[model samples]
Target: MERSYPRDPEWEAMPDVGLEVWPHSPPDTAAYGEARAQALQAPEVEKPFSENLANEALDIPRSQERALSYRVSALMASLARLNHCDDEPTQADMRLIQEQRMLVAMQLAGSPSLQQRLTNPAWVADCWSDALASLGAIGVRVENLPEDCPWDQDALLDGPQPNGRNR
Candidate 1:
């Protein structure tokens, strides 16, 4: 007699959604990281010392907003091209772009509202869904996938919060 491991027949063959490959959460993190990277890259406003560093604290955030906007523009273009390609991007390739998309959406949210962030965090679930839905129509689902992404949250928050709070 041969020994066999018992398992749910429906679920036994389901693909593993490891932490790295989880579609939703990881991509969100990556995009925020990249957005932050962009913000930090922002050059100090060319000043003759008259600007007086005009709030270096807030200036840096503006830099980030600019960076995220630029990156998201590029990503949107790339996504459009992917959609029009002679051969649709593979699931793997689509997922990679979807991660970038999630980042942009997160950036769009800007900083967490004073009443937001770790508490009753509604930003991630809804806007993320909207962005992913648009991408999904093109065949790439940004569901629970792993994150191998680069986002820049610090920069994105520099502009304004999506809910119109963090100006």
Candidate 2:
């Protein structure tokens, strides 16, 4: 006689999700609702010093509002390019640039009150010029990736150990 193990046919046929999904209790209704409400109620954080200076520049009244908005857009595009191109900066410097760019973008995009303030031509020009200069100063040369990687340099090991080390 042969011993046999029992298994569920349906379970065996199920497709693999790769992760184990454990059975869990339904979320507590009140707690879940409260958590979502709290998330939604979180306050906006204060802008940093760099952003404050840029905002001040933008706030100065100018006749060419459209041009200033276009300049802001151009600055944002340059920042994105710098980030994508592997121009390495220290983490703190990167953070500052990102913060300033985002604030400028937000002001350009949807903030009517902010947009109203960012009209001065001189200030807007100075703000973007300074930002560009700062970014240019920190950018390092981008290096090209090697055609052959270090891992690929190693030859594959075929079947086994020499010198009485066979497993």
Candidate 3:
């Protein structure tokens, strides 16, 4: 179940100086790509009622809450299964572990300490523009960029997610 981003030449050329691991392409681009294409083809009037209803059924707050709930359920199940473990995890188990780790990282990104570190004047002064430019080059919307320093919790947690991709 391991997943990877589509390869990009620009990403290859960028030096890996360990500031941030730039994704090869937008996260979950491949997984939801077909859905996006289908959405584009179907006119608003022709689209299914359930599809239109779903859009308004869950707002940002609800979506985040649901994601966290699912993540917790998966983690609890994993821990329960691992309690009696005596051998190496299978590939499936490894995938679950990776997924949970990515979710945790995304959650941590919103923590005050991590947010402070990201906005530290010293590091941000050196890397903010380059980071934003690199993301833009990969077709990630520049609107994802924060408006100012010390970004609020909503903004910090509102950007793209790894969506369980191992990378």
Ranking by TM-score: 1, 3, 2
Model 1: weakest 10-residue lDDT segment is: 158-167
Q: What is the C-alpha lDDT of each candidate?
A: 0.44, 0.40, 0.44
lDDT of 2 by residue, 1-167 (tens): 99898999999999877344322322332233333344434454334644554344333322234444555545533443344454354566555445555555554443333343345555444544544454455662213211121111011011111121111
lDDT (10s digit) by residue, model 1, range 1-167: 99998888899778777644334333234344444444444576355342443344345445555555455544543443354345546676556566666675566455432213212224333333444455666575344321211223343323221221111
The clash tally of candidate 2 reads: 3
Deviation from truth (RMSD, Å), model 3 = 21.4
> TM-score: which candidate is best?
1
lDDT of 2: 0.40
RMSD of 2: 24.2
* Ten contiguous residues minimizing lDDT sum, candidate 3: 158-167
Per-prediction TM-score: 0.34, 0.23, 0.28
List clashing residue pairs in candidate 2.
Answer: 58-118, 59-117, 62-119
Tens digits of per-residue lDDT for model 3, 1-167? 89988999998999878445323443432223333444544566455664554454334334444454355334433432333234455678756656775674574443223334333555443344444455466565546344332233243234322222221
Q: What ordering of candidates by lDDT runs from best to worst?
A: 1, 3, 2
